[model samples]
Target: MVDADQTFVIVGGGLAGARAAETLRAEGFSGRVILIGDERDHPYERPPLSKGYLTGKAERESVFVHEPAWYARSDIELHLGQPVTAVDRSRKTVTLGDGTTIQYDKLLLATGAEPRRLEIPGTELAGVHHLRRLAHADRLQGVLAALGRDNGHLVIAGAGWIGLEVAAAARGYGAEVTVVEPAPTPLHQVVGPELGQVFTDLHARHGVRFHFGARLTGITGQDGMVLAARTDDGEEHPAHAVLAAVGAAPRTALAESAGLALVDREHGGGIAVDASLRTSDPDVYAAGDVAAALHPLFRTRLRVEHWANALNGGPAAARAMLGREVSYDRVPYFFSDQYDLGLEYSGWAPPGSYDQVVLRGDVARREFIAFWLKDRRVLAGMNANVWDVTDTVQALIRSGEPVDPEALADPGTPLDTVLPRA
Candidate 1:
């Protein structure tokens, strides 16, 4: 067995990288752990960037996952503001943008995903923005703060989680918010049309304008600032600022260039891993959004970019590196906070797979729980302001119970009573 004091190099200082380092220390591996990140700041919580932090309700000091002192105290070296340009797999060394090279015994590619940009004419316009990193939020906050003084029109492209949350936040700041989604409803990708309607109604109630099923053609700018956008339908919409939240693709360039086997190239797919999150290369492991793990429950390969997945999978990958193979069974979960509402969802029930849906509360009121049943098995759970249903639905999923549709929709029945104890 190799000595733990040899070396452990982690790329990307996101939640996954930070947690993996912490977990490694806890697992009794005292090694020269080095974390490399392109971002200047230390690892901080990301979910808040679209929620309390964007709304200015949360302070900058509260955003960090741990104080700088924590990493120093734990003996984890942080290489910030330096992007890893290349990896020499033959020699087991990574070269940074500044031409610094470091060798590693065990390498973890925790390189998180990046926000995708629409390839349109006015993409380089001054007012065009994307909300992914802390620097992005800082710039957006500045734009919004300036807009507050004068009623500014904020146009958001793609109505995904970040787009919708930004819409809600901009609206709260009194900016005229418009969300452009190619689909008929927002959240169609995650919750399906039935529940997507629920979200649409919620955003509608908040005075947000929705341009469903409209494709953005190109942005028109004047003097490097955006003025309007042309739609696929040949219609032009005026806008003061534009935000593109279409989606994100994994950052797999480093892994791919180093002769790592990637699942797909067109979509920027990541290193395919087994049950223990070990990549095809035995010495290399991956976790978080960049790693695609085999889903035992879904019986498929999925790369989940959820908060819970990063939190749990990070530690699991580190344990695997320590020669302890532990399979991650935690259901993939994510939460979105939009305009006084909390949306929490667990498990994956890809759209069109479910034949029936069970409603626990009123969707119109924005307080409800939607259970997706595929062949009478609880495949997914979506709740808005009804957080208590998570454990119940998760238990049912774990139990693999063939719950009756009638029992699922019954509000009178206690959720716990319906689910098996333990």
Candidate 2:
């Protein structure tokens, strides 16, 4: 028995909020639903922004999650290009940027995230770029094309996922890429040095230069346009364009003002929530990048900034809001595409969390599965150009069973064969 008079309001029009709204209708909730977004564009998946869309492989309309009429037909109250400036939790209301206030029976925050702006000098230059929004990607696509057509050099700051993907896209347009990172390898904080070198070599072989063990100190420019990227090592990499692919920070201003508990910066900061995605306020919930959720398997708070989290988390939060039994313990998953190599990674194994990494198949051939193990217990697994096996790998981690490294590394031994018997 659901309350037909209730009104549910979702802040943030990203994939998570859209999916949650869809789930509400699908789950037989006939109540009123209102969705607000700061950006005018409809909800869309972000993967293509860095992958296909940036490279001109995907069309502008392909990234959207729904056809335009779907929201109207579904009876969802849609508000676009309006930032929710304040939240009155005690009054059960939210104030938009233009001073419009709306009341809600239940509130969901999926405010998502924004790119971490570069604090270095010359960031205000015309040719410097950051790629977190649709508008940014659109502008960057033209920049890459012009650079490639002119045989210009592009310097990228940071070697994170965004950086590497943009580098690959830029290379496809025939532009020279120089990636500046402070770590010894690309994605050092993520896949760690062992797997980082794989990406390093991948881009290096494709004519992309690497300036590892260095940071972009500043940008040099003539007039209002960028000329080159200056590294902390006292070296300047010539460039017609500079892209700061540092990272993103979760948008949590509304949550903070509402007095919601938040995770610390060092712990991947976001609104702190329990297993059920319930924030400090019972009527207020959060999901996607903004929710620092308590993961049961990992026994730690995780704020995953991947598309899968938003894809799955939204529906889970919706179910919880409906008073249905829910324990969101899905295995963390994400994938990446760079040039000819495609990789799918499952589970968590940040650096220092795993003691050993075992490989199955040939690493040199770019076809293999890398397993991170802690005391023989598999913590995470990544398959590079190796298809399938995600279910098996995730199951092994969920089983919490220690496996023999020899059999885990054997290509002939099927991954599931090593799992504990039912």
Candidate 3:
């Protein structure tokens, strides 16, 4: 058994790292916990960075998870602006950017993910941005402040959550926004085409131009100023600034160097962790976007890059590191705000596996709930401004009982009515 005062080193200071530290303290672990982060600021909410925070509706201080005093009170030793350069797993020590070494009884990796890059010309040009950190948000905020409702042109690549949120933020600045996505419909991968069509309609109503099925050819700039983005279809559009929201890849360099097993799928690269979020090495624990967790419900490997997952996975990883046998089987849920619409999605639908989809409300009003069914059982469901049934649907899906699609589609039918009594 390890001493209560044993030092615990946590890498990455985002939600995962912060949550792990907080959970450790809450669990009565009075150990020396050192959080190493490359960024200088305290852990802040990242979801708002692409929406309210970026649009200037929220201040930087408002997004911070905890004040400076909270970390001190919690006794979490924070080493800010210091990146971990190397990890000697054999020695059980990590070398920091400044060459400082810290020995750890246990290590929790929550490094998270980084924005994927577009390796074309003009990517390095001025006015090109990616929103992942507070610093990036600050920069974009400064740009919005500078433009000041002057009908500026903002070209954004990718139509994922971040891209759409950025578009909303840019539109709030009164800028002419155009989004380019390679998918046939925005959110095609997540919600499928039927719901994606509804999302597309909402954006179109708000004047967000989408260049669907458009391939990025290159970005071009003249004298350090971004001029336009060229599509593979041989079309060029003028823009004042370009934002690349092409999604993110797991930051697993440190994990790979430590000889951790990684599940390199066709989609991306991420360190592979078991049901309990443990790497091949038993002493090492990983969570958040960096660790690809296996979903027991789907009986397949899945990685969620959502705020809820990051917040919950961190503590779950900490628990595992603390020798607590627990399975991280929480139902995955995520929210996205764009164009005055709030979208809440829960659970998963394996590709083309859902046999039927039930809609609870009118799609034209932009408020509805769509449930995916497999063999008359609820597999997954999404709510658009209809979050009341989130808990009910979550329970029903996890109930492992077959649900009648007809009942789910009937708006007059209450969700609990269909649920089997406990």
Candidate 4:
């Protein structure tokens, strides 16, 4: 069933692709593995780009998924700075940017996502930044430090996780931060309206200003440098630098050009894939942010952009490629560390999907577990500054049994005992 004559080609040298290659070898596949990416750096984890790396708490080497030598040691071909320009699904080949075509028995696309730019003018001005790649973080880390030392102002667009984490890092450097968000509060789409305020207050207490319900209309700059950012409400905020954290768009050009079906825009577009990460063509697979996978639990196509998704999904995809019985139904999960607040969220319960937001533990002290419930069933849970309960919470969600609200809120009550048709 297996042969060394087969070659597995993985595009995109991010965490997902690298992990897939690793899993292929770990799964006892001795076939040739080629990993391609546009970035000059080796595969690296992204979370540090917005968190620890920005704060100077993490070293440059820590961001890498594996040492540069590991790829060579593992006998995996690493092609950094060469992006796969096209995919020929019928021919079973991928063309690199340099026009080199490689034949593959299986192809995994982990092209990941690109940061969305501001449509407004003056974005090209100096001091305008984005934080999606290690290269961006390398530059922004110095920019934040410079701004802090000079007592400069940094205005950020969007109050999403990237924007807020950068805001926290800016404040840690003693730089002024003003966040412009289109929503009424921060992280509205992810955590919902109720929990959004929690982040808003958290950042406010740390001296970060927020301009809610506003869009960037224009940016004013001087001498090829950003001076201020203009809001739709006709207000201008001073800025030495501006970071756009609006969002990221999945990189699906290769998949689309190859005639692979993609999820519709309304369903959060990405390369459409089945539970096993197989695209329209069974030989082709997509993972990480570029894949909109059919989740057995959610019973719908869901695309997760978090690091955990890539970390786990890549291995899952590799197993599937090996013709193993695979079901990629991992719970949607992500974590954030902003200032003193560190949180881990599990399961998917975006706004209207849940009936109510219930809290347990101390809210004022910022040590609590919040749950999103529907018909008394736990859909999702987020524990902020509270450790060691994620396993219990995930168990509750998987049980699919109604949980007693009173018992869930009681500190004396153990969470495992509150489930199963309560």
Candidate 5:
């Protein structure tokens, strides 16, 4: 049981950290709670950074997870803009960038992740960018507004969710855009080739050019500003601005320094945690993108970078830290918005794990639900422009029962009917 007077220090002031603090209070832990973060701003949702916020559809205040006043009212201390340089597990302390040390009885590492920086030459140029924080989004928005409609060309270096969403936003602002991907298809690893084609076709219809199976060798610049990006095949794509959306790597430096065991690199390199979100060190725990927690459903330790994981994992970790019986076993879920299409995906199945994909609606109309099955068992499901079926899909995945493909693919059959009877 948690001692009533013990102090709980939470590292990383992202959604996970904020939620964990909230959970502590809700659980009646009146102990001192402190949240530290490197960013100057309070915790905020990141998905809108590429979509609504970048496109000017959402305001800056709307993205915040909580207002500054909320922390004060909740009795949680905020240590913004101070990076934690090291964690001294032996002393039960964390040293900040300014050399300030904070002691704690228990700690939560929710350091989240950082964008994988491009190491190619000319990355330091003025027009080259990476979208990870709100500042990056603000800079990109300024660039878009200055260019006017259809006047500027944007070259996106990766075709992942961030790249594609930025492409859609750029197109919305009337900027000519081209996406270059080293893979054969966009989002090939996540949605696979068949469904990936749907996105390629959608972007093509909106006049967004694509160069697949190409590697970016260097970015050519003029007056220290990006002018074009050249591929390994020696083809140069002209651009007013370039965005490298390759992917993000979990922030694990502090955890490593503190001697926390990380998952094998093949499992996506993160602080290894059990179902309760406790690290190998009993006094330390991890959550959000930094924790590779064992999933009861998948029967494997998986590190998910989606918003849902952070949202749910935070409270679960907090409860576990309080010595409460809790398990972070929610099915992984994420969503993306590009152009006019909104996509919701639930469950996890590595690429090539599922033998077949069964579709329930029209792909051409962009309204459908697709299910990936392995030996008739639903492994994952995605809905594009189709609403009110995610819970049903997640239920089917949780049940782990065999589902009939004919009924799964039939548009006439409701999704609820596909599940096993109570």
Candidate 6:
């Protein structure tokens, strides 16, 4: 049971930490809440950093989860730019970078994740970058603006969502862009080949070039600035700037050092937690990217690095901390925007788990909904340029009822009507 006088310490002041603190207050927990972050800025949303903020379509101030004043008003202690160096579970306290030891009865680890840095040579060059924080996006934005229209070539190292989004934004700035991926198609691992081809075609139509089944061996530089990228295939791609969008790994050092159990590295390394988001230690909880929790719907452990998971998981963890009967059971969901294409995906179905993909609407025209099915049961679904059907898509996955492919493909059939009756 949580005592009202005990301090609740939250590490990692990102969206997850902010939301957790908000949940604590809303749940009537009058305990002292301290939110610690290594970054100097207030908690902010990262999705915009790759899209609107990088393209100059959104302001920097707008990305913050809440204004600085809100923390003070909420009576939540904000410890920005302070890294927690050690977690002493025995002492029930954490030591900060500044040598301050803070005691906590309940602790939440929301350490989030970091962008995977490239090990290739010339990564130290001035024009080489990676987008994970506001500062990185700001630097890339400046580099793009300086390049002007077709004045420079931007070579992207990976063809994942971040790579594709940055490619669209760079092209919008009139910079020639090229994307290289080890896979055969962009997002092939996530959305599968057919749907991935849709994105590949979309970028190709917008003047973005792609090099599939390729690996960036090293970066070549001229006078401390990146000039080109050398791939394993003996091709040198001209690059005025290079953005490494390879992917990210969860920040699990703190949790690991504290002796908390983590998921296997092969299955996405992060602190292991139950359905209620409680860690190996009942006094400690975890949420957001740092948590690999059991998903009741999937009947497996899943860790999502998307914005929606952080937005919902934090609150659920907080409620559980207060001894409320809660389970973080929402279907995993995420959305991305590139050029004119808008995408929303719900549920999880690993590659090869789904035997067939059912397509509704047009794929070539860049407007459609696609569902991944296993044994004629919906496992996951995604919509491109399609609006207001996410709820129905999620319901289908939750219902776990076998659905007919023909009804799903028919435009006249409303999505809600396709579900099995309760």
The digit string of per-residue lDDT tens for model 4 on 1-422 reads 33559899999899999999999999999889899989999999999999999999999999999999999888899888998888887789989889999999999999999999999999999889989999999999999999999999999999988999999999999999999999999999888887888898899999999999899988889999989999999999999999999999999988899999998867889999999999999999999999999999878899999999999999999999999988999988899999999999999987689988889999888899999999999999999999999989888888888888999999889877887853
Error of 2 at 143 (Å): 0.8
lDDT of 6 by residue, 1-422 (tens): 33448799999989999999999989899889999999998999889999899989999999999888999888899899999999999999999999999999999999999999999899999989999998898888988887755489999999999999999998888889999999999998899887888988899999999999889999999899888999999889999999999999999999999999999889988999999999999999999999999998899899999999999999999999889997789899999999999999998988989999999998888799999999999999999999999999999999999988899989889889899887
Question: Weakest 10 consecutive residues, lDDT, candidate 4?
Answer: 413-422
Q: Residue 269 error for model 2, in Å?
A: 0.3
Instruction: Judge candidate 4 against the unseen true structure and give its global Cα lDDT, from 0 to 1.
Output: 0.92
lDDT agreement with native, every candidate: 0.85, 0.93, 0.85, 0.92, 0.92, 0.92
Alpha carbon deviation, residue 59, candidate 6 (Å): 1.0
Query: Once all C-alphas are superposed, what RMSD does model 2 give against the true structure?
Result: 1.4
Worst 10 residues of 5 by lDDT: 141-150
Best by lDDT: 2
As for lDDT, the candidate ahead, 2 or 4, is: 2
Ten contiguous residues minimizing lDDT sum, candidate 2:
1-10
Question: Compared with the true structure, what per-residue lDDT tens digits does model 2 show for residues 1-422?
Answer: 33559989999999999999999999988988999999999998899999999999989999999998999898989999999999999899999999999999989999999899889999999999999889889999999999999999999999999999999999999999999999999998888888888998899999999998898889989989889889888999999999998989999988999999999989999999999999999999999999999999999999999999999999999998988887899899999999999999999998899999999999998999999999899999999999979999999999888898999999999888989787
Instruction: Give the worst 10-residue stretch by lDDT in candidate 6.
Output: 1-10
Tens digits of per-residue lDDT, candidate 5, 296-346, equal: 888999999999999999999999989998778899999999988999999
Give me candidate 5's TM-score against the actual structure: 0.98
User: Which tens-of-lDDT digit does each residue in 1-422 have in candidate 1?
Assistant: 33555788999888899999999989989778899999999998788788888889988778787899999889898999999999887798989889999988888999989999889889999999998889899889878777666888888999889999999889888888788889998988788888788778878888888888897889998999888877888877778899999988888888889888787855337778887888888888899989888877777777888778788888998998889967867788899999889988888888787888889877777788888888888888888888777887788777777787776788887777777445
Model 1 regions more than 4 Å off: 1-4, 265-268, 420-422
**Residue pairs with backbone atoms closer than 3 Å in model 5 (clashes):** 150-174
For residue 366, what is the lDDT in candidate 6? 77
Query: Which whole-number lDDT from 0 to 100 does residue 45 have in model 1?
Result: 72
Error of 4 at 269 (Å): 0.7
